[model samples]
Target: MSLLSPALRRSPAAASTSVTAAGGADALPLRFAAVGRSFGTGPRARAVLRDIDLALAPGEVVALLGPSGCGKSTLLRGAAGLDTPTTGRVLIDDTPVRAYDERCAVAFQEPRLLPWRTLRANVALGLPAGTERRTGASRVQELLELVGLADQADLRPREVSGGMAQRTSLARALARRPGVLLLDEPFGALDALTRLKMQDLLLAVHRGSPTTVLLVTHDVDEALQLADRIVVLGRSGEDPAASVSQLVPVPGARPRDRGSVELAALRSRLLESLGVDAHRH
Candidate 1:
């Protein structure tokens, strides 16, 4: 049986109920309703996801976790409207996400900055066309400073370290002032220290702007630290009808201590769900 039953499928009207059930009326900032995605058709078909029902509330961070090819990123892309779903819908603020808009932005694992452009220009690139040059410039400057890249504004992508480039990508995403930010392992490639720093930065940004965030990652610790709720996608080759296996609530306050017993237990449980024995690592 699917984790989400037919009756439990989310509807626009159910938004209020879901949020209330989740403990507060304004909890969910984003909602997914019977969302499914597939590529091709029939004989040449491949179903990436099926029956996904998720809710991400403002001031809340949710993580998407699963083994590779389990559609973790595919689901994120669908939510971002970077990929269209063959079935169901993705809604932000109860509205469909179809084409790019200022209300939503995404940052991927790689820092996709233009090699030729300086950091400032890269971030400023997302500014709406016909925006006053002065306003655009000010917005870029503000975001650069927010991401701690103000000093590196003149540097090109190649001139900065991987972490710095990723920060630039983050700044660019934030430049849109998106109400929903989708991050697909934005710090996955950084060194350990850099990764932790980036995670902290992400938390700070989310708290400051109070945007709803959906972070896709395989790292259990990452999810535990950043997410208000952790969702585990089924493994590859599993039934397409499967929904998230577990929805683990992350307890504790921001700037959570990773070495704490609570975090360690959550990490171990998540690793186990992913079929990895924590002791073996």
Candidate 2:
């Protein structure tokens, strides 16, 4: 039997109910053109990213993999419009991205839920301005249900487990019905078992919603399990800027067999790209 709910397991003929535009309608693609980011001014500037040229097809799931300080999160933040690139530009559907156009949502490692509000209220905060309370409440309930937190809708953030809180955070992000979802190490704070479950839940959610996903993760297995393509970033000797070192495709559909020989081989190659020897373990 499948672990997903019927709604999630059903193949998406259109986008999820949370879609920003028409439900199940086509989403816009994201593009990064020679992007770069640096902190501070000349002579003291620290470059984080450089010459990052990439594109994400509508509804495709892509993973950014790299060591700490390799600018994976910085790249994601640029796409989210939380940070601007110091060089080049980011575009969505061929339009220059100066700010989030109600088309992007972001989830971070920490839940960052407001302690004062109930779970439902926390989620409702994601709704656009001028939304009626009744409508917002309905959307909150729907998202809570989707993330398996409906029963805990009234609880405060302090009352929930870390994983549950993260789920609530995800629900809040999805509340916007964004076309692009940016995840930055969202499961890194959880235990191994909980992380595995979150990965599965993410897959189920994606299967139902069908949005463009840009996930920043350190786990090779997690990227292999969730991403259609894995982008690896690294820095060269004495250069602070991180650049794309490898961009490899993971050819398969969703619900891929984790133990399949093809994935195993691909995992081996990915590990090598990160300077790890698969045979050692």
Candidate 3:
């Protein structure tokens, strides 16, 4: 099956190749150099991630897949500076990340919009602290339009459907014009149809802005549908730490054929890699 709908393929934004960062520079590359994370110390210490050396080209989208507690979220969080790695570094544009920077934006599984804030107001919350009032407002308006939420910009979080709320959350994440967009199962909370639409929306958004994306998801099909590369993490040793076990590139262009023989083969491979026996089912 065609991964992208005809309407999505014909979008004007789909023709754009790159998105501008807050400073108008091109999207930045992301790197994880010997990255590892652990909790506690000594015998009680638990390793969550280990020697995660990976790189994402500017405007590339990479999906991470693994079983629970394999540290996919931890790895993504480390890149976002939400959690510091116990070893090595998470770098953007060659500089080591010390804390959350304006260059990175994250969208979580939950919309997490402030209950009291209007969608526009929530989006504006992502603007840098020093943004001029008018500029911030204009940016919020632009992002809302970008995410197809201009009509609902004034609605409160409770007033919108789950899909619309997620769109609002996405608009908020992009309000800062971040070069790196980190997504943690952003569509996992939605129904199947909504999830598919959101996936298409993400592809269109990426085509328009072309920001570097690191998405963590459990769905193999979702990975094939969106990622340029799928990185599977697993624990090779008895240790709990999860490391990159395989890196599989998704062939063809964006909006790939979901039901094509190629995708089917890849899906089977990925499922096997994830410890699933696709043939038995």
RMSD of every candidate to native, in Å, equals 6.2, 5.3, 5.6
lDDT of 2: 0.82
Candidate 2 regions with alpha-carbon error over 4 angstroms: 1-26
Question: Per-candidate TM vs. native?
Answer: 0.87, 0.89, 0.91
The predicted structure with the larger lDDT, 1 or 2, is 2
Cα error, residue 31 of model 3, in Å, equals 0.5
Q: Model 3 misses residue 160 by how many Å?
A: 0.8
**Native RMSD of candidate 1 (Å):** 6.2
Per-residue C-alpha lDDT of model 1 across residues 252-277, encoded as one tens digit per residue: 76778888997887788889888999
List model 3 lDDT by residue over 1-281, tens digit each: 22333443333123234435333636767889899999999999999999998887767788999998899999998888889999999988788876887789999999999999999999999887899998888888878888999988889999999999999888888777787899999999999999999999998877767778899999998999998789999998687899999987777787877778999999999898888998974
lDDT score, candidate 1: 0.76
- Looking at model 3, the pairs that clash are 1-259, 19-209
Instruction: Output the TM-score of candidate 1.
Output: 0.87
Query: lDDT of each structure?
Result: 0.76, 0.82, 0.84
Task: Order the candidates by TM-score, highest first.
Answer: 3, 2, 1
Q: Give the clashing residue pairs of candidate 2, or none.
A: 14-24, 15-24
Writing each residue's lDDT as its tens digit, candidate 2 over 1-281 gives 22223333233222233333334434557889999999999999999999998877767788999888889988998888888999999877677776766778899999999999999889998887888888778877878887899999999999999999999999898887777889999999999999998998888777667777899999999999898778899998898899998887776677788888999999988888888999984
